[model samples]
Target: MGKPTGFLEYKREAPQKKDPFERTKNWQEFQLFMPEDKLRQQGARCMDCAIPFCQAGTTMAGSGEIGCPVYNLIPEWNDLVYRGKWREALDRLHKTNNFPEFTGRVCPAPCEGSCTVALNGDPVTIKSIEYHIVERGFQEGWIQPEPPKTRTGKHVAVVGSGPAGLAAAAQLNKAGHTVTVFERDDRIGGLLTYGIPDVKLANEVVERRVQLLEAEGITFKTEVEIGVDITAEELETSFDAVILATGATKPREVQAPGKELNGIHYAMDFLTANTKSLLNSQLADGEFISAKGKHVIVIGGGDTGADCITTSIRHGAASVIQFDINKQKGAMRSGDNVWPLYPIIHTVEDAHKEAMAVYGKDPRSYMLQTKAFFGNQDGQVTGLQTVEVTTELKNGQKIRTEIPGTERTWKADLILLAIGFTGPEQELLQQLGIETTSRTTVKAPYGKYTTSKPGIFAAGDNRRGQSLVVWAIHEGREAARECDRYLMGSTRLP
Candidate 1:
């Protein structure tokens, strides 16, 4: 420990965010970094426990099953930060996590939940410290492209170009294999570039990493639909090995009346178009969905729902409301949620806070289920019918039952479905003749990235359903190792 009494003397402090109302005016990041001394003090708050659960990366029994899936060296970086060794801190942060910049902004920080100090008091500001370390590295020119010393003469193809695909390509390139990333979209990043809003993660941040990757001898092929543009057989014949990192993007649909209305749209369609238009023309070309002066209703409260709410607010929506089927959680942790696990409690996110500020009230409603959609004469969505639901535990699963008399109607000019995704699209997998699980995900056993067919591997959401970016990176790294082993017999990748 850098200071034995540091945890006792210092309290956790996070970076400040811009005013909610003011920040919603633009699509820029709002977080401001902490001063060096204050950040060091926050780093000092790390307890450096004997068995640091923050980096356990295990699937324990209970709510927060996993901690840092990438197994970040939390204590070592914390101590380095406390000692003002920022360059060393950045080096340590990059050991396991390929993109700390992305996770620092988007990840929910399960590491904090598993922190030993969080049992009694606030956890260390690990995420903020991580962000600063990388940002500082970039500023000081410590981060640069390091090409492989020698080429392996083996070429590998990675499909997707999302977090998983990028990480896999990076590791494979480090192993001296010529790596090419295939992206269906016009841009490089699949989710990071388009799925996530720029207000949380700026395009510049993603572009910087992409530039570095390109400089490091990795090739990115965008607007190339592998199955359609080039046959899977051709791809297999061209490359020594193929890694499928395509994320789970098939959205779960709601079976409700008037589902085909003009104003009713999927969450990805809205988010993707808005981002594309913003980057292409700054919304000047009018190619994106317009929530301006419209009453918006976002279904399924989660991160995607929150993104919709915030995006609608920025578009000058007249009103915004979000719905969740599950009942609202308690303010404090429940009895079953003990220490060192992610607490099941109500928490406010940036979008929620922004919605409250702009709409003058919290825009979320719990225990409400959508029944049907009501449209106007023009066939555009005008309102929605909903019914209140009660949760009843049967056997071990929670069942939601709608109450008959609790039906109601609400005005909704635009409806965005923010429900989660199902699994990856089946066209590419079917074309490759790969097996899948009952859940429709690619049937790759846990830890082993090999698919049913030889020379083909699966990772990320394509293998393990929709998940966090950290887990995607982990899967990509492991899958690259397996792919390397398959090609060269023995591998040196970690």
Candidate 2:
């Protein structure tokens, strides 16, 4: 709990972000750090609710209904940070989450929504406070590698090097198990390394954490893909246990006429290429993909689409348009969308705001459906035919009906498909004889995290499908605890 009168004394204040015009021209993070004094004030706003829903991390019914996925001791840590006990606050944060810095930057802060203060006013800036605490911990040299003093003879193999795998590997190593992580890519940190752009998540943060894990005696093998170049049989024989964190990467595609056009690219391809190129040489040799002088059309209205929009603007696209199938949401909180639930309000994101600053208007159009893709003789995409559709809930089912006379055509040279991921890739799961759901996620009991194969566990996007990094970290920690118990008849890693 924070100061008894702190909620009344302090108003919520989040960190300031860089101006859109200046930020869009470069591939740097836009989030501004709050001054220590300001961050302390924000942390003090945490109220001592009799029933703290903020740390209750469950997704079933009213259980996971509020707060954070990692079930972080929000009130306690907030109080610690407010009292200027930065190291203690970091310890409290690490008790639940292995990586507060990652969550602090990218998590949507569902816990903030579940805050009592949010019922009437803005929630305490939990995410920003988290960012400040962890950043301070590093600055004060409190964050150091704590390798287990003793070693357990058992060994564990983690597939994929994303948040989940990285978290599990770190925790398992702390438990003194000889842990080795296998990443398919040339670099470690799965989506964090490739899929996400530098503007959102800088690569150095990921590399730093990974380096800590390395210093703690964990081994990372990059460019060694399991089930492809390496076989599951080899891994099963080599390691005592296997934890699969291969994320849900199979991108959802919008199939239409002329789908094979040269200019059409998966959002991941564009993002990954851009990030790799930037890191490799900052595109100095002119080897990076450029959206310059092109009319860009980004499909899918989720975060990925927003990323594509911003990237295109930064790359100097002539025009950019975002097509969303869902209806436009309200500008502010609605009657049905009360506090403690994520407010489903329409607002400009960093990318959208940047696009507007340059384009003079938001780039999204609601209720638009792509009818077909038009291509030129050189197999390059030229345009797309679209029809406006209205969404209605008919007989307990959501439906989309095309509106008459709303069909139109738009010019485009580049198209980025960002329709989100379907699920974990099926081919590898099938190869391992691990059962999967219709949604393509690994079939395992909730909380248990046990796969069909004994000594094999699955978590993160691989088990739950594409989700927030916080959720993935939560599952990774939970699964690691379970895996430890399975390995050694009992456990204390949680």
Candidate 3:
């Protein structure tokens, strides 16, 4: 898109990050700005493929996400950045993504995974270029509140202040509709403000975008929950349309012996409290579950597990280890992990780097499954028992087996469960008589987003279960478009 031989001339150089040991001491973001020249060089790596799978927005045959869920104009922006047109690149970015800042920080970069350049070596630094584009836009004062010229006089009540709700609110407001977002938490940015660790998606980043949304005339109400503070009937009578963006927060609990130990905590509970306490009084509140001076063991593996390890290290844990039930992936992609599909390979995350710097080794124990938890006489957790597992393919399905005589016990005072989530909470769904799938997520088709009753819609994690922030934003925008159509019999949202 930029230069024909750019991919061949330049090697991939990821955006610079703060030193692991130093950054872990504080909760500030670890990602540093890249110089514009370096960014342009990376942008030039975007080879003009006959068909760029990076923006396909569809899942190929893979074990992971294949492309960008938001379907970002990746090549266009890449070319723009290569040409040093920062403002035009930003405009292209904002056309598809409501919040590039969030995705750039937190998304796993499936776009990079499916890049045409990635077919051989590394992909273009699309994520960093996107981040720099938006941040530069903010720095140059190109991004300001552009409130709609006229109001539709239609009211939209959005539940949850997470990415999905915020996207819906923003888009609806752009269409000149009055939108009010209701959040049960004390603050806005549901998962953005709480679920993620600050070192990854800093709270300030979220607050800044939320403030811009407020300036654009979207109303946000905190500590106000639907089905508790206000009834579903009351909401239907008050607002013209309702959108439940309440995320899939019901965490999957570990089923093991002695599970009721005092030190066991859900990942979100620990992360939320840590961020809250950090923001409230720089953690002086002592309101969060601390890993200080304690041996910590995190169950499950993924972003959440890594987050737990990083947080534990920051809290000055004596020692930390993570348990993963699956076998470790290879360094390179397997044959089945074909091109355009997300490569299933092992990679080190920021948490692993920090933990390695602190513990002298990787904090992960693959193929180990937690068997039981052990509690002391005081009902506080002392440790946990785990066993080695062997996995094999059987009739196109994976079969797991416990290895005999491979059971081991590890000492730990704090155990954090980062397994995953089941689905959204059921209070509002039940109250509103909305049907859910077998997965317990809200029953709404992907594009339509209509619930059992008209004027009531569902989107984001509540409808799609646990997914990426970009996907949540996509659904939020789509749902708002549908809601607009329902209200006005026509729509212009994209």
Residue pairs in collision within model 3:
none
Candidate 1: list runs displaced more than 4 Å.
392-398
What is the per-residue lDDT of model 3 for residues 258-330, given as tens digits with 9 covering 90 to 100? 9999999999999999989999999998999999999999998899999999889999999999988898899
Q: What C-alpha lDDT do the candidate models reach, one value each?
A: 0.92, 0.87, 0.91
Residue pairs with colliding backbones in model 1 are none
How many pairs of residues collide in each model?
A: 0, 2, 0
lDDT of 1 by residue, 168-199 (tens): 99999999999999998999988999999999
Candidate structures ordered by lDDT, highest first: 1, 3, 2
Point out where model 2 deviates above 4 Å: 60-65, 285-287, 334-336, 393-397
Put down candidate 2 lDDT per residue, 83-199, tens digits, no spaces: 888889999988988898898887878888788887877788888888888888888999999999999899999999999999899889988999999998888989888877888
Query: What C-alpha lDDT, on a 0 to 100 scale, does residue 397 get in candidate 3?
Result: 84
Worst 10 contiguous positions by lDDT, candidate 3: 58-67
Q: What are the C-alpha RMSDs, in order, of all predicted structures? A: 1.1, 1.7, 1.3
